[model samples]
Target: MSASVTPGEPGIFERMFPIRERGSTVRTEVLGGVATFLTMSYILVVNPAILSQAGLPFGAVVVATALAAAVATAAMGLLSTYPFALASGLGINAVVAFDIILGRQVPWEVGMACVVIEGLIAVALVLAGLREAVVRAVPTSMKLAIGVGIGLFICFVGLRDGGIVVNNPATGVGLGDLTAGPPLIALAGIFVATAMTVRGIRGSILAGIATSTVLGLVFGVLDGPDAVADWPGSDQFSTIGDALDPDNLADALTWALVPVIFALFMTDFFDTIGTAVSLGRAGKLDDAQGELPEMRRVLLVDSGAAVLGGAAGASSVTTYVESGAGVSEGARTGLASLVTAGLFLLAIPFVPLITVIGQSVPYVGDTTVVPAIAPALVMVGFLMTRLVQAIDWGDVQDAVPAFLIIAGIPLTFSIAAGIGLGVLGHVVAMTAAGRARQVHPIMWVLVPMFLAFFAEDWLSVNVF
Candidate 1:
């Protein structure tokens, strides 16, 4: 049955979003949007918290995160007419922070410029009709492995951020003082979030972060915020437009960074395809060919969001898998995304509260601090790992590469390195198995590129 409308007259939302045609109501869409916002809102705190460690001001990142999410999510709704909401992706942001920015010793502006470059590439691929081709070129096992490996990597970071893991001179990494105030708060947060998730509670991750923040305050591990809300000004948005600077873009376009850009692009590309496909399936929105309606538009907006997010210094915004929450709440159209976008915009004034939630608290000593939002990271990492079972462990050719990715990412603390190793392992394993003919031509192309990427430092000095 079509959605009910006022007798003989459809409302504006009905005309704009075609709610009746999609078998949904404005009320339902609004509810689903709120559900999605709640489910993924943890990014408001977590994204800035992670980026701030890379020298971004927490307040500015907070503004950038909210504005980017609001704009991107709104565009998704209005342009694609889909319910998927966009935000700074967790794993991608981690790569920007730990690998691109810190590991490469580049300025944060340059790191963000990489996001813009990858996003523009993604846009070009979509427009040229090559996005789907690229997706098919990758082996299914490697794709699944990439997500699983990133999940483990994110979880490892969460553990460290929460003081659950500590550096040890003897063994590299060991357990931290769980009995300590900050660690205890984190433990309680993890437990609460886990239980809430198991109980099917909405916004459980955000709740977990809130719980930890409250505990930190009570235990004196965190200081209280001076205000609940503060109007943000132009000066507060210092991170905005940083990615668009010519110098940053030029720096990011160096010859040595080509592989890095490809790596980031691959992550952003595959992740959106996976999330959109899964959400479409769950919502029964896919057609006979299993393609969602307006899929091209969806991809365009999601890809462009990476550019917007990076320019705003919020990393690469992509379609959130948590949008499945909205889908589950019976959202079938972009109206839901519009609602989610509005909520994100409404959240901007509460930056002070978000800052407090993301604030770091002293841990082992004055030199050590633990994030209040670490539990959200831990929970999100667990959610991302659900794709692991999709890998065919029985096949040695696939398993070898999958294992390399799963183990290498966290162990090496480098997403790019892990992906490179996995791709190399896949090529070698397939050749060894006498099935080289079956490997995609693209995989072969990537092998030499990855080898060069791995040897970039040596080549820079010896050859370049």
Candidate 2:
């Protein structure tokens, strides 16, 4: 009877996911999900560590992180049928906690309320198709360049976070001592993973991270877990955003808050776009228009995740580029994301294992080092770099912007700025070459918006 059933029905997992067409199975997808989750699970602890600085309770943020990420990612799989997982975004969290809450003296409650507001706006834009329109208006070069820029930025983050890249007062950045234990292990993982990748092996990125982690444990670089689990108390749960009052919401409606909201929106918008483009290209999953299939739905889910995360007392959430880890592992369907989401929920009971293994940072004098996760990021960055060849490098108008995006992303340490600069370069270069008439009107509109972003930055530094 089961074999007699038709394939057109949606009830069957194989029918819905089309595992045969994707050359994937439940087993492969499950393994891929585990790999992807392992690569980015550091977010579980990192998000709390960052947000707690804003007076949010650490344990509560952990629960919130898992809750928000699990819900968003599960929705991604079931709604958009994408393998991507969503989580509290890195840059957006910094904007929320560091810039908005700490620097602007806005309480964490107000900042989260703004995040909810931003997400609502995003929902409107996506549902109205304006978000897709703006994305399509961007020049092809700019889109491809944004992908490359994010790839470079990921590598930069890996280097810095791994303690392989250090600061210098004389110039800007200097190399870390390769002789040190933490950095040396990172370098070793890099070499090992690069070799495995070159050999066309699967799961090289996750494998490298595991090998490095084992080494860290053996060398006493990574300490054991402090506890088996630390369940968040009532004070930790639902504490943030609980203080959001009518007065604070009204106060946040002032002109001063516009720039902050705009900045938050821009960063979230571009980071999600860049990550999507790069991941799509890597998987050969996007349409010829450089848009993912059912992308609007994906954005809707992403925006909704942000709102839910903020309301749940976590930071802004979005789709993760670390999904590439799963994609590379042959996860061609939503089942992979479902598996990853399940892991996130399951890991809640093993908080100690998570913190000790994936999120550990040992203090070496004044600096704290995370030796395991950084190498995985570096490996993933290396893998994502193959998207660069898709750019039209022969045209100087194209190449210049591409180069700016690729370089500026890492140098300026801002993904949104990198995308903006790339667009700016493309428009100016095209106009200078008397191709102004051929340029898209959207570029003209966007150029000014990007300028406004910079201008706002200037005014903040000089005027404010």
Candidate 3:
């Protein structure tokens, strides 16, 4: 039934992952993988909720998100032999929803096509060995600012989605009724999750989502699922392969959209590098220079993940900082990633449960559908803001761009625009401070491109 091996020879798993060489065993890797999955599993509900707003089917997105995550994460493990997991990224999903689809008035398919295009471009960059050049081109302050800005943007969106924030005709934004069911539940969830996070609990965000869902059910604000379980079929994958459709691809490939694609690429680019480096250091997997071994392989997998995610109708998938949870639990090899990937696939049958947790509760009017996942979003934003300390705030040249990014994101409701503003701010601040030589030449090229991006509509009407 099986091929015989020499008595002292390493088994298949051992040879493939070299678990013992990494100072770990199979049991440790599995446990670490479980810990990692539990911490980030909130994305199952949250990603669907965010993408559904852009007209993606909630159930279909749930399936796509899980499958895409499984495939991407598994590829990362097999190819790079690193204990990192990939999933539909938070800020990028927001871009797909609010910016490309809603703000630009494009169809969901077109937005996703843009994601695919960005991914392909990233793959080309990695293959051409230009990824590092691009990475070094952006100032570290600006890089940190992008994450911080996105955190604020996500937090703002969470507040609005949870009914904790509402639009005001006079002031443009105002607080919502905390006494209402949705906002009340959101507040309770925030308290619980924040407390758990402070206590060093694993899966704190998932816990918060569960608590909010329970509260929503108790208050009759959310409806129970009609079915407890169901088999996943082809029809449930409504959005799959839409990104590769000819018409959608054509629509996404246009000169007017170059800046948008660049924005997506930049976000995806920096996020992977920063996350990989941090995870590597946390796991003690980095070399003397604080760089990950086989980093090019890792980047390749991550870049390919974006293409896979978009083709599957998920947003751009990338390395998760939550992989640190696994690292803390002694996950130092690809085995842990394999375990996480398996868990994601195993979760496919539980689509109904995911939908129940992500289901919208119409709160104030037909326009507002409050989600239970808001607390997690708020917590994620809080985590990202921690990066603010790493920025050189004392230097005005550094502070200006970072400040603009932090303020621009939530204010403009567009991550791409916030990044654009930050880049422009960086150039202006450096030039004004007589430090213009420090500006990367690539940044100069981006200045006019972003300017054109901001004025695309006007240019289309008057010049283009």
Candidate 4:
């Protein structure tokens, strides 16, 4: 079918092909498509890098993970009827790759097993009706904090992925050397792309990536036999089993595997829920009960993706809030995901092209770029930007909770922890001022849970 025909209402094709619907005719679609493409282009190169770091073959992780994300995301749109796209989650990848794989030193197979287990847990939670209850248990302010925090976190991740930020021993953390090599070239490309995006250039993100990649090659940032391999060819179907040996499997299961399984499930569940709630607000997909239905579908798709990601030899799968960037560009249905999937599938033939691009990009140099902290920083900035609407600057009691909520996220590196602390601070402030009656009973329940969560983490660290 062609575009939907109702006036002011987008057509089916428009709904299906979200990027194309931003404006009325082909021109609008092209603009939206470019924007959509730019926003997502990073995944094409970044996902493979992250997954390969976790010990999967680059070829297998890229092709299989992309295909798995496509299938699960399409199912989300087709079944739940939401306009969300799914991909290997942002934070969860680090957790899987670093904590599970490197820290625990688990085999990729065991990491995949953990993903599958986590996915099953998520599915079970949704079926048990815990999804809504858990979300409701969180306060509105806290939820908003999480949303903004994660957004900033994602942006930070993008900067890192683009090689704009690197660690420094002398300054603790500072800008990379931009003038020395590919990092400089990459930074230049990002700036150009960002400028183009600001100037309303469609596909600025894609352009930035492409420009940086080309510059990387020209500057000798990436060169080797691996760099020149053909795109799709027979290499694309390589699997996890290729790198995994039978001898390592037994040892990996005994030590590394168990911890990874636990970490992946717990981290993905919390991260998925947080991102879902956050992005749902951005998309404005509130349920009849005033909650975001997208949150529920997020749980489902994320969980399913985790399971499939395991089979496909990737880490824990979760929803991509980056999709919200696409939504902001006017994607309102699964069609956006289908398009994303289609793009991934098509890229198979150009695998070498993407590899080259990844190698060519440069890292960001200098502290001016901002610390590689979580998205909480951006969320705080966003909240402060609208502080007048959400809170009164004159009231210390009301403002303290918000302050703690914002500061606590990055300070602790846990959004839920920050929220929990904020709630406790709110409760204490109200009680001390003789306003204890104003506190909701439901809020009381969270205090204990928060305490337990922290206590567990503490005990694990101390004892284990």
Give lDDT per model, in order.
Answer: 0.89, 0.74, 0.89, 0.57
Give the runs in model 3 whose Cα sits over 4 Å from its true position. 1-9
- Candidate 2 structure quality by residue, lDDT tens digits, 1-464: 46765655444677668566767777888888897898778677667756766778666788788878888999998888778999998767766776568766787888887777788888999888798666567667666665566667667667765678877779898887777778877777777888888897765666667667778778877777777777655655665555356766666665455555655676577668777777878877888898788777888898898888778778788999889989998887888889899988886766565555454364445766666667666765665567789888898988998899788767776555666787788888989999989888867876777776657758778877
What is the C-alpha lDDT profile of model 1 across 1-464, one tens digit per residue?
99776685878887888788778899999999999999999888899988988889899998899899999999998998888999999999998999899988899999999999999999999999998789888888888888889899888888888999988889999999888887888888888999999998877887788888998888788888889999987877999998899999999998667777887888899999889999999988899999887889989998999999889999999999999999999998999999999999999999988888887766776546555777888988998888899999999888999889888888989888889999999989989999999888988999888899899899989999
Q: Give the TM-score (vs. native) of candidate 2.
A: 0.75
Give the true-structure RMSD of model 4. 7.4
TM-score of each predicted structure versus truth: 0.97, 0.75, 0.97, 0.65
Worst 10 residues of 1 by lDDT: 362-371
Of the two candidates 2 and 4, the one with more favorable lDDT, higher being better, is 2
Cα lDDT of model 3 by residue, 261-285, tens digit: 8878988999999899999999889
Give the clashing residue pairs of candidate 1, or none. none
RMSD (Å) of each candidate, 1 decimal: 2.8, 5.1, 1.7, 7.4
Candidate 1 is scored at a TM of 0.97
User: What ranges in model 1 sit over 4 Å off?
Assistant: 1-6
lDDT of 1 at 357: 84
Arrange candidates by lDDT, highest first: which order?
3, 1, 2, 4
